[model samples]
Target: MKTQIRLLLLSLTTSVFFITTSCRTELNEEIGAPQEQTLTANSKIADLILKTAMNDGSGDNILDGSSCFDISLPVTVVVNGTELTLNTEDDFEEIEAIFDQSSDDMDTLEFIFPITLIASDFSETIVENQDQLDALIEACEEDQEEDDDDIECIDFQYPLSVSVFNENSEVLETITFTNDEELHDFIKDLDEDDIVNISFPITVILSDNTEITINNLDELEEAIEEAIDDCDENDLGEERFIDVITSELLEVQKYKDNQSNETNNYRDYIFDFSEDGTVLVTLEDNDGDDTNNVTTEGTWSVRTRVDGGLNTTLDFGTEAPLNKLNNSWNVKKIQEKRIMLDEREGEGISKDELFFQQI
Candidate 1:
């Protein structure tokens, strides 16, 4: 009997200890601290994210709220006083997956204590057009969620201003970004021509609203060249030919046609847009019965307006699988070997969006 009682007591004690431990873990966030980019308009840019920018599971303490970071530093940014570093692209991606779902305001980056980090906030800043610039500015002006201890920190320190140029290489306007109200004002005054992807030496805006004044002349010049293309084309802009569109290595990429905001990523179909405006759609696992892995052919072209916001139009010839892509959609944006196209609200496209990347 004594031995049995002892055993029972030991088991109970162990159970109690475990329960207490679990409770502590559940409450750890309250006891401890928390931690937490951007466009290519919000989630597309992968390299710009840093591991240090993640939110502290609590969602209330998103450190890299502005998606701004200085990669040159070992520790990119601090969140709730914790130091973090990005070892790989995955580190940044993890943060992107978490905080992006948040509609709440984010916490300003906070250092552990007395630690100094000197680095250029963002390594590369590409303002593709006026819409992108507006998106970047709006992202920065977003208010940090309402809280008892939330800091009223905007993305930048303040007195932020940037120059806008026309396609003719003329200065259009130099607007100063101060608060969300000012951002709205800037947007109101924005013209389609002011939204050029043409010239470079552009001031890249950081997720934190911080600005890096023309990192180099190359990016600036590239942007200007793109602008010249548009200006030279009489504002209708030249076509993004099939060759240039599909020239991103090996000539193929997988695309997910997300309709009604739903993505069929698992479909994983390869879209091969050839130089002759022909599109070859292919998928694996041919059964020769019911659903053959047949290559579907289609035509493609870049339109100036009907596609709305200057993008490409695809005609899959009303075929079984190709009919889904028979709409004119704007180029959502392109990064390296990837191309994303989506339908604008006022545009004549009925589908949602298509995301393509070299698989």
Candidate 2:
């Protein structure tokens, strides 16, 4: 009986050991295995990723005159007889001001060549002369009749994070991109089975400088599609009007306050905008006479907004009636002898209108 009991105890002990070892092995396998996730081939999110990562050519379109590529900066250019070293994107406005100096004269821009051209894929080509630059522009124009696929009106605010997962849904790595170039290359070289999940709550800036938060892939794709063509991407319209504002001797023809439902025929005030950022304001006597005119000096400037839109700002230093017009006004319409400007009150709910006609 003693031998049988000892044998039974040994058998129980062996069985417990085997059971514990088996359970541990199974648990280890489960913990070590990778999880599975799917990123569909040619998916909408994938396409959006590619588009967002594409090079933005419109930012430097003023320099290259092409929407397909950007001219690398620190280039010298002669703008209407004025030599300017354009080291940054902000210097483009100086060129525009030069072009606006004279509406009647032919605006000229001559680049000091041997400048670098950057393509949509971040490839670089050295353009030695005007001929080479022209060739590139011609090729780009022929290739794309409409605007390029790059969505310039909206930009992804960077330092974006993404996770790469394997077939078993195990995260293999996490990548962070600080710029479009890095993000573009990574997405372009993605493998067929690689699953990339973007860390969400990314911010996108619209052409109006409005920020939108995207929580998932669907929202990002939708935002890009909606804002792709929402802005004046070419800035051609703005360039044409800049000349009109600076050249004409303008008088306030009408003013309307939307909030108070008031209208004023401001035919008494004449404005002359000088290229040197000064304005001569002449206030005519309200009694339908030019005899008792009061002349005053004010400052005027055409400023480029963050979205690339232009705002004409006027400051008269607390002068009555003119002080009321001291806000940054958006150009609404530009005609041969008349320009219309409006000031909006919060998301354009209400507005004050100001019309200027050449005197």
Candidate 3:
């Protein structure tokens, strides 16, 4: 009876030990395994990542005239007989403003070369003279027959992390990219069968400085598609407004004074903006029987304000009611049929409004 009891107890102890050991081994395996989520090959999300990571040359298209490449600064360029050393991107606005000052003269830009040119893949080439630059530009033009594929309106806010997984769902390596160049190269070199996962939530910045959070690949693709057409990617600059304003005869649609809290309806006035810096204003007197009209002359110009905003200055020499619109009005909106403007007093927008519509 003692031998039987001892044998039974030994068997129970052995069974319990094996059960605990097997449970521990399974738990360890589960804990060591990698997450199974991965990005699909040639997916829309992958395409978006590639497109957004591509170099955006449109921002400096004013200097190079090629959407395929950008002229790296601190490059010196002569703008309308004024030599300007553009040290940064903000300086490009000054060039546009200078070009906007006059529409009659043929706007000229002369580059003082030995400048660096950055390509769509973020590669750089040093050009010694205009000949070399022209050759590169010609090549870019040939290579890019279609519209540029870079999505300029939206960009990933880095640094973003991505993990590469192998066939067994084991992590091969992980990388953190700090800029577009790194991210672009990684995507460009990816193999079709490579399993990759991006660590979210990532942030994307829109053209208007709006920030969006992306939790997954679907959300990222949707965001890119939605914001792809949100802004003017052509880099038309101030010239866009100049062309619209000069091409038509406009009439005062709405004018209001914030200081006096008064509104004026100059519906009977017709304003013509000539390309030669002259403005013709014709006023019609509304009577019960017949219409009498008076025409006046004014000088007009578009210039860059100290704060880099475009302003349209009007000087209708001592003319009643028309002279009230004489301030250097800041451009608020420029539409096909309407131009909106305002004047600010000191800190906040004074709300003194002026609007012109096509007649």
Candidate 4:
């Protein structure tokens, strides 16, 4: 019930492929990346120059002189006194190239006098006739600013805060962001292996003070349903459900297939879940040869829903129970002695189902 980092039905994996294309394409032009960088007026120009070009590179955060890492073709940058049609890394090298270098060494270039940069998508940034590139580099040492702690200080873009909560409806932590630079620091400090999966209703307080709340599991499912309803289902449909649940196996307690004339074949089934994400189903062979009973195995997992509920699933190369438990189910009670899974009105496996009890 409290704020937690839970599922938002956002494509966690597919988003990885298109995140730069989707999010970074329209970064605020007024600010530099890594906003906590200390810079003189000269280095500010350089950083903005590199940041804008790297953005144009589209997914390469740093310039490495490769085509993928190269700033796109036919752009213009007025460095020193020359406006060059900068297409490739070689074109950039015309300004300055080091041959006495280590292969791993990052290639470097300093802006010239009366510097100006023109990106493919952004307007021009100009610094007119200040000093030569070498003179500006010399001034960086003289102009570096210091903090109260005597460390070099980089200007930040202000601060924000986000709240985190847990499954028991308890406050876990409230994270504060001092600035855009601090945001990078916070991400860099996180241990991916140590990240905990909490129940949802996670709230983000942006710098401009707006709120986005993915309240519950049903809401996410509704979002997917609505998204499909708004467009053709053939287009990126699985991307819609990818974040909700990643293929969990549900135990077949009592399956009553309405289309089949089957009744007594559903008893004496037990489920075993292995650490390697394998689900094994052992059931009594009422209809088949008793001495040759087989074990059906697949994959399984339970994830926290947006509403603080849990989804339990089962799959063995089919969609009987997986399709059923894919929807949100409330937790009536859970303890060492017993567990209760409450199913709501939706696409369910059974018709006369009351509740699930495991003791």
Candidate 5:
């Protein structure tokens, strides 16, 4: 009986000790301190996010009632005493993931520190779980779902190659087109005077039920050059485009607000043409009062307006045109003044319209 009692007491004591140790570990593992970047596997850009909140100022405390809608500026952050740098682009995903998994709560305002800190920290995690950290960073750095704006596009205003062939597919003429005075002078000497390809039309189907079209390449080019010159007269050439419709002016709200009532304002857009005859475009501007202060930004599907023969019209995806009547679009490139839209069309349209130069 004595032996059995001693054995029972020993077992109970061991169980109690194990439980105590486990509890102590759980308590120590609590995350109370700021995370260090060197120990992380991802690259994060650090930007300072300021919000108007009602929190006590530790100089690091966020303001009262601030949310993600607040203006956020891109910034770089250094961590581990400036030994590491982080870029928001790289670590945005990973940090977001960590927040999702670890914290049941989130702050309305967040800060992105810097990129330099991330670079330094990445080098520190080179050994041991460096591979793991790298994998984590890559996973976190997974490219965010990009909108149409993230699509690849180009802007070209130059000459291109065009080949003319008879029904027999025999090459008749191969020529290049350019707005350059020298090139135009050369084309003027052509004997046949038959142009297989022409400039891409500048077409705008506006919101107020109006359509503005510019089909003449020479006229369109002249208008753009003239507008640019006019802005240059006031030394605003570097600042303003020849024609600006709905445009966005950052760090300059009052001026932007005056230009258009649309919340997203800014006439400048990106235009890209692929060698395979794909035209891509994206516009950046807010078009309303934006009372909530969330700067509106989005992109538009590139429309294929005109084909090479001047009479052919190609339609891109079906999206109602939101452009205003006064909006101006321009063709930036033409290969022998030819626009390429498909393969069956020989040598594709050479001259590519690069962008909609809003007037």
Candidate 6:
């Protein structure tokens, strides 16, 4: 009986040790093994953010910018056994958190719905990051320059021009001159439709090549219209007129001819006045296929009546021309005419100015 009791006790002790050891082994495995995470296909949230970054004024290449995000921590984006890093620029960490919470269980291969970018938390964070982003852009840019190829040059397709005239085709005012450096300085001081009065003497040539010097505004306007009406009417629609009158103006019409294979072409805008001072402007490309028929309806006014028309601030009304051009920028020089401004990581604006003489 004593031998049996001792054997029984030993057996009990051994069983308990085995059970504890087994429990510990399981616990260790759980602690050591990586959690099975369901990796979805590349997220559209990623794509949209990347698209915005591409146009973002930071000038960083979009692909390079995307690659810069290193997501090696609390946020993990896994694809086909490969893990990519997510850069923290633009407050992507917030996006990562949102993506984490929204992802459903499928710890390995999973087709998940896209992450939302419009959530209040995400939106606020994105906006804040965008505001502070300029501070961090310099460092990001340096990193990009080191890691990627230079960005391709963005070229403007058309040379632009703006000329003012009276009923007799008189050139009242013109801003289509070259001399980029000086023009840039000139435009910096003037607001839109704010008639920038200038008394510079300009030399004009008649259809007979008879050059006449005019110092007064009245004389200049008269001479300009006569030259335009009298210049070879056949060559009027062509770029030669622009080139002869306004030096350095690109022959966009001709240049576009070389790109005739393209479905979309530049739209021509001709702002002219009738005898009764009615502005009749047509916006259409004279050349190209039917696909090129894109036009926008817009209003026009002489600079004098722009921005409340020379009245004091008290008389200001929203209907004034200055109001239309309130926040708009103008170009005084051809070289400085093309401008590309990025407002945030994903939003950008580009503008190119062309100038032409009324003559």
Highest lDDT: give the candidate number: 3
Once superposed on the true structure, which residue ranges of model 5 sit more than 4 Å away at CA? 1-196, 204-212, 230-359
RMSD to truth, every model: 26.9, 11.2, 9.2, 27.9, 32.6, 33.3
TM-score per candidate: 0.30, 0.56, 0.59, 0.23, 0.15, 0.16
Worst 10 residues of 1 by lDDT: 35-44
In terms of lDDT, model 2 sits at 0.72
Worst 10 residues of 5 by lDDT: 45-54
Candidate 5's residue-wise lDDT over 1-359, tens digit each?
Answer: 99999999999999999998886554333221122311111111110000001111111111101110111224332221222122333433333334235222322222232111111011121212334433433332232111111101111244533333232342345556443232323333333322233324544222222444545444434343333322101111100121121242211111111233442342433333333323344553456433533222233212111120111122234442323211112222212122222112233222222223222
lDDT of 4: 0.35
Q: What is the number of residue pairs that collide in model 1?
A: 16
What does candidate 6's lDDT look like per residue over 1-359, in tens digits? 99999999999999999998997566434332332211112332222212211211221112112212221222233432335344434433333344335333222211121211121011211213332333333444345435432111111111212232222332245555443223323333333333233323545444455667655445544554444435212211111221232332222221111223221222254333222213333345567565675433333211111111111011112543212222222212112112111111222222322232231
lDDT at 231, model 5: 15
- The global C-alpha lDDT for each of the candidates, from Candidate 1 onward, is 0.41, 0.72, 0.76, 0.35, 0.27, 0.30
Candidate 3, overall lDDT?
A: 0.76
The candidate maximizing TM-score is 3
- In Å, residue 106's CA in model 4 sits off its true spot by 35
Model 2: clashing residue pairs?
34-168, 35-168, 35-169, 35-170, 36-168, 36-169
Q: lDDT per residue, candidate 1, 1-359, as tens digits?
A: 99999999999999999998887565443222221100111211111121111211111112222222222222354533434564543454434344334424342333333222211221235343435533543343232111112112212223545545443444445566544335334443445444212122335443334555543334433333333223111111222333336765222233345444334532545667776667777665545453666666777765323112245668767655557667776665544455667765663443466766665
Ranking by TM-score: 3, 2, 1, 4, 6, 5
Predicted candidate 3 versus true structure: per-residue lDDT over 61-155, tens digit per residue: 66765556778889999989999999998888888888879755767788997899888789899999988887777666555434557787898
Model 6: CA > 4 A from native = 35-321, 325-359
TM-score of 6: 0.16
Candidate 5 local accuracy as lDDT?
0.27
